[model samples]
Target: MKRIMLTLILLVGIGGYTTYAQSELSLQECLKYALTNNQQLARIRMEEDMGRFKTSEVRAKALPQVNASGQYTNNIKKQVLAVPGELIQEPGKTVLLEAGTTHNVTASGTLTQTIYDQSVFTGLKAAKAGEEYYSMQSVQSEETVIYNVTQLYYSTLVSREKMIVLDANIEKISKLVNTTGSQVESGLARKIDLDRMRVNLTNYKTQRTQAQNQYLVQLNQLKQQMGMSMAASIDLPHTSFKEIESKAVGALDFGGVNLDNRIEYRLLKKQEELQEFQKKAYKAEYYPSLALSGNYSYNGISNKFDMFKGSGSTASWYSMAAVSLTLKIPIFDGFARRSRVSQASVTLKELNKQKEETALALNTQFENAKLQVQNNLTTIQAQKENVDLANEVYNSTQNNYNLGLANLTDLLDAETSLTEAQNNYNEALLQYKLAELDIIKSNGNLKSLLN
Candidate 1:
C-alpha cells in the first residue's frame, strides 16, 4: 500500500511538471519556425518562381527554332493540251500534247529566326519588369508575415506572464486559507474568517483556470501560425523588467519614403512605366511590319516512276534561293489601336495618382506609428506607477486587516483595485509592443526582427 501511494505521488508530480512546462515558448524559436516553415511564405515563393519562368518564356522568342518536313506525290495520268494555232501559223489541225506527270519525293530541313520584332522586344521588357514586381512583392509578403508572428509571439508571452501571476495569487490565497482554518479550529478566529478565505481561494482558482485557458489558446495559435502540428506544445521563457531594459528602441530615421526604394512605390512606378511601354507597343501595330525572308531548296524532277534513274534517261535537280521583303501596313482596324493607346494612357495616369496617394498614406502611417510609440511610452510609465501604488495599497490594507483596523470589505476593495491596475499595466505593455511592431513593419524591416 505504501509503494502504491508513493507511485501515485510520483505520477502526480510528473503530471504537474508537464503542465507547467507547456506554458511558454521562446521568441527566437517562434520566429525561426514561422519564417522557415510557413505555408504562406511557400506560396509567395512559388509566385516568384512563376514570374521568373514567364520572363524566360518571353525571352525565348529571340532564340532560333528548327523544323524538318517531307512531301510525296503520285499522279496516275499525264496532263494533255491542244497545240496553239499561232505556233503552227494555221488554224487547221489541232494536236494533243502531253506533259507527263512526275512522281517525286522530297525532304527538307529549315530554320526560321526572328531577327527583329518590336512587339517581342517590348513584351520581353515588360516580362522583366513583372518579374521584378513579383520579387519585391514576395519581400513585402515576408515582412507582413514577420509582423504577424511578432504580434502573436508577444501575445503568447503576455498570456503566459498573466498565468504565472494568477498562479502566484492562487498560492498566496491558499496559504491564507490554511492559516484561517488553523485559527478557526483553535477557536480564536471566527468560522466566518475561514469561509471568507475559502471564497477568495476559490476566486483565485477560477482566475488561474481562465489564465491557463488563455495561455493554451495563445500557444495553439502560435503553433498554427508557425505551421507546426496541432498537437505540438510550446514552452516560453519569462519576461521581466530586466529583459525590457536590455532591449533598446532606436530612433526613427526614415528618409521620408523614398519612391524608388520602397517596394510598393517601386511596383507602382514600374506599372506606370509598363503602361507607357504598352502604349508604344500598341502603336507598333500602326507601323508597318517589315521582314526579310529567304528560302533555299533543292528539288528533283523525274518523268520516270523510278527515283534513281540511270544517266541515259534524265533526272534533273534544281537548287534555288530567294530573298524577299514583306511589308504589312495596317490602314484600318476600326479604331482598335487608337482605343488601346488611349486606355493605356488613362491607366498610366491612374497609376500616377495612385502612387501619390500611396506616398501620402505611407507618410501618414509612419508619423502616426512614431507618435503612437512616443505617446504610449509616456502612458506606460504612468501605468507602471498606478500598478505600484495599487500593490502598496493592497499590502497596507492586508496589514491593517490583521491588526483589526480594516474590515474584510476594505481588503476586498484593495484586491480588486490591485487586480485592475495589474491588468491595465499588462495591456499598456502589450499596446506599446504593438505600436513598436507597427513602426517596424511600416519601415519594411521585419526580416531583422523575425529571421
Candidate 2:
C-alpha cells in the first residue's frame, strides 16, 4: 500500500509539471504553435491539396477510358412471322413461322482514347495554374496569421505592463495614506488632508483592479489567436523594455522596401495568371476535338436456358468487333461560344485592372507603415522624457509636502501627472511595437517573427 501511494504521488507530480510546461510560451513559440494548429491555416492547406487532386482529375480526361457491360434476356412469349406457303411448294397458301429463341445473352467492352482535344489540353493547363494559385493563397494566409498572432501577443504584454505600473502606484499611495493618518492622530495634519490621502489610495486600487481585468481579457484574446484553449492557464514571461526598444530602433534602419516582395502582390499576380488560363480555356472551345473508339461483343442464342451450359446444336455463339475515329467539329450554337469568349475577355481585362490597383495599394501601404513607425518612434521618445520629468516633479512635491512647504493638493496633482505620464509612455510603447509590426508585414518579412 505504501508503494501504491508513492506511485500515485509520482504520477500527479509529473502531470502538474507537464501542465506548467505547456502554459509557458514565448512569442516565437506562440506564433509557431498557431501556424501548426490554427483552424483557418489548416483549412487553407486542405484547399491546396484539393486543388492538386482537381488538376489530376482534369488530366484524366485526356487518358484512355475503358468500360465493360453485360446483358441477358428470357423470351416469355415468342413471336411468329408470316410466310408464303408457295415458297415451300404450297399453292396459294400462307404459313406462319416461329422466330427468336427462349434465351439470349450478350457481353461487350469499349475503349476510347482522345487523339486531339483542344479543350481538354486547355483545361489541364488551367487546372495546374489553379493549383499554383491556391498555393500562393495558403502562403498569404500563413503570413496573415503570423501578423495577427504577433500583434495580439504584444498587446497582451503591454496590458500586463500597465497593470504592474498601477500596482506600484497603489503601494506608494497606500504608504502615504498610513503616514497622513498618523499625522492626523497626532494633530499635526488636517483631517481633510488625511481623508484626501485615503481617497487617493482608493482611486489607485480601483485603477489597479481595472488594469488587472483588462490584462486578463487581453491575455485570453491572445490565447484565442494562438488557437489555445481559453480555459487553460497560461503565463507570458516578462520581457525588458530595454530589449523591446532596442529591437524597435534596429527596425528603423531597414533597406529599401519592395512592393513586389509582398505576398499580397504575389497573390494578385497568381490570380491574374489563373484568369489568363481561364480565358485560354474559353477560347479553346472554338476548336474541334478528335478521338478513337473500339468495341468487342459476344452474343449467344438458344431455344432453352442452356446458352452458357452446352455447345450443343441447339445453342449458337457469335462475336463482333469494330473500331472508328470520331471527330466533333464545332458548329453554330446560337452564338453561345462567341458570348463566352467575350465574357472571358472582359474578365481578363478586369483582372488586369485589379492587379494594377493592388500594386498601387500595396505601395501606399508600405509608405504609410513607414511613416507611422517613424512618427510612433518619435512619440515614444517624447513620452519617455515626459515620464522622467513627471517622476522628478512628483518626488520634489512629496518632499515639499513632508516639510510643510507644499499643500496636499500640489502633492496629489504631481502624483496624478506622474501616473498619467507613466500610462501614456506605456501606451506609446505599445503603439510603437504595433507600427513596427506593420512595417515588417508591409515589407513582407512577417515570417521573420517565427525565427
How many clashes show up per model?
Answer: 4, 0
All candidates: TM-score: 0.79, 0.90
lDDT of 2 by residue, 1-451 (tens): 0000001112332321223233345567678778876778889999999999999999999999999999998888889988999878897888888889888899999999999998899889889989998898899989989998888877877787777788888888889888888888999989998888888888888888898888788877766666665555655544456755555455557455686778887877777787777777777888999999999999998887777666455778999999999999988888987888888888878887987898888777778877887877777778888999999999999999999999999999999999899889888888878887887887789888877
In angstroms, the error of model 2 at 342 is: 0.8
The C-alpha local distance difference test score for the whole of candidate 1 amounts to 0.71
| CA-lDDT, candidates in order | 0.71, 0.80
Per residue, candidate 1 scores C-alpha lDDT tens digits across 1-451 of: 0000001111332321212222333455556656676778879989999999999998988676566667766756878888966676767777777774577666665655666678778888888888987888788776666777788877876786777777767776677678778878998678987788788878878888898888888877766676565544456656664333223243444434444545678778877877877887897777666555566666666777666666664667666666666676689989989999999888988998999999998778878988887776667677778889999999999899888888877877787787778777677677778887777667766666743
TM-score computed on alpha carbons, candidate 1: 0.79
Weakest 10 consecutive residues of candidate 2 by summed lDDT: 1-10
Among these predicted structures, which one has the highest TM-score? 2
- Evaluated against the true structure, the overall lDDT of model 2 is 0.80
Residue 265 in candidate 1 has what lDDT?
80
